[model samples]
Target: MDWDRHNRHIYNKVIDSFAVIGKELASPVVLAENTYSVDEAGILSSVLNSLKVLAGRHELKTHRGACVERTLITSIECISADSRHLKPLIIWPATTHRSTWTTHPTRGWHYGHCGSGYTDTMISLHWI
Candidate 1:
C-alpha cells in the first residue's frame, strides 16, 4: 500500500477529511471572517477587557490585533446584587445602571480553539 506516493497525498487527504469533521463536531457557531482595523481593534479590546472583568478576571489583553470572534459565554450566572429574581439572560449596555447586579463575573473560558489546519496536525500527531 503505497499510500505515501505523490508526496503522501492520500495520507494528507485522509487527515484533511478528518480535520473538517473534527471542526464541525467541535463548533456550533459559524463566524464570518473580517479584518479588524486598528481603531476597531481598540474598541473591541476595550469591550473584551470589560467582559473579562465581568467574568472575574482582572487582567486585560495586552496584544493589539484581530481575532475571529466566537460567541462563548460559559459563565453568565452571577447577576444578583440583592435578594431578588433576575432574568435568565440580560443584555445591557455598559452605560446602563438599571440592574442591581454589579459584581465582576467570569466565564469558563477553557474551551479549545482549533482552526482549519490544527485538527489535521492534531490527528497526525495522535497517530504518531
Candidate 2:
C-alpha cells in the first residue's frame, strides 16, 4: 500500500484502541487529579544563520558565518488533565547561575543550571 494509506491505517488503529481503552477507564475527576502531561523544548538565544536583508537591485550582499554568541536553554512545562499547570522550568547550560541571564526573573517560575543544559533525572525530580 502507499505510504500515506499505510500511515492512515496505523493512525486509525491507534485511535480505535484508545477509544476502547478510554471507555473502560476511571471517571474524569480521578484521572484529572492523577494524570499529568509533560513537554520539553530547547531554545537557542540567537539565530544560527544570518537573516535576510532587504536591499536595492544592484546592492552587494555579504555572507556571514554562524552567530558568535549562542546559548542553549531547555524549558519544561507540565499540565494536569483538569487543566491545572505548574510553573515552567528553564534549564541553562552552565555550572552556576548568572545575573545577566535575566534582569527581571519571572514570578513563580523556576530556573536551574547544569553542565549539559539539558533535562536529566535530577532536574526532573526537582521539578516534581
Candidate 3:
C-alpha cells in the first residue's frame, strides 16, 4: 500500500491511459470540445508544456508550438477562472475559427463551465 513510492509513475501511467482514450474517442475531427473536462484540459496543458520544453532542448521544428501555447494558456485561464468568457477559454487555434462552436461559455472559463459552480479552486491549490 505504499503507493506514494510510485505515485508519480502511476499518475503518468493514468495520464497516458487517458491520452489513449482521448485519441480513441476523438475522431477525424479532433475538436477541443470532444476532449472536455478540467482534468483532461490540464493534462493536455502539462503535456504540451513538457513537449515544448523538450522541443526547445532538442531544437525540433514544430508548428504545434503555437497551438500548444495557446491551448496551455486557455487551459490555465479556464482552470483559474481568470476569465469570465468561456469563448476565449475554450476557443483554440488548432482549427478553423468559424467552424468551432461555443462550449461552456458561462462557467467562468473552466471546462464544463457550470456557471457559479467553480471546482478548480481545489485544483489551483494543488497546483500552487
Among these predicted structures, which one has the highest TM-score? 2
lDDT, candidate 1, at 14 = 79
lDDT of 2 at 7: 95
For model 2, the stretches where C-alpha displacement exceeds 4 angstroms are: 1-30, 47-68
TM-score of each: 0.18, 0.64, 0.22
Question: 45-104 in candidate 2: lDDT tens per residue?
Answer: 755466656655445334434554678899999998779999999999999998798789
lDDT of 2 at 83: 91
- Give the per-residue lDDT of model 1 (tens digit) for 16-128: 99899678655645332221111101112123422222322222244332433533221112222233322222222233233353354334211112232122343333322
lDDT, residue 50, candidate 2: 62
> Compared with the true structure, what per-residue lDDT tens digits does model 3 show for residues 1-128?
23555695688898999899777766766644444434323323333554334444234454345444423323444332232222323423332344233543564442333222232454355433
Worst 10 residues of 2 by lDDT: 56-65
Q: Per-residue error at 87 for model 2, in Å?
A: 0.7
- Pitting candidate 1 against candidate 3, the one with the higher lDDT is 3
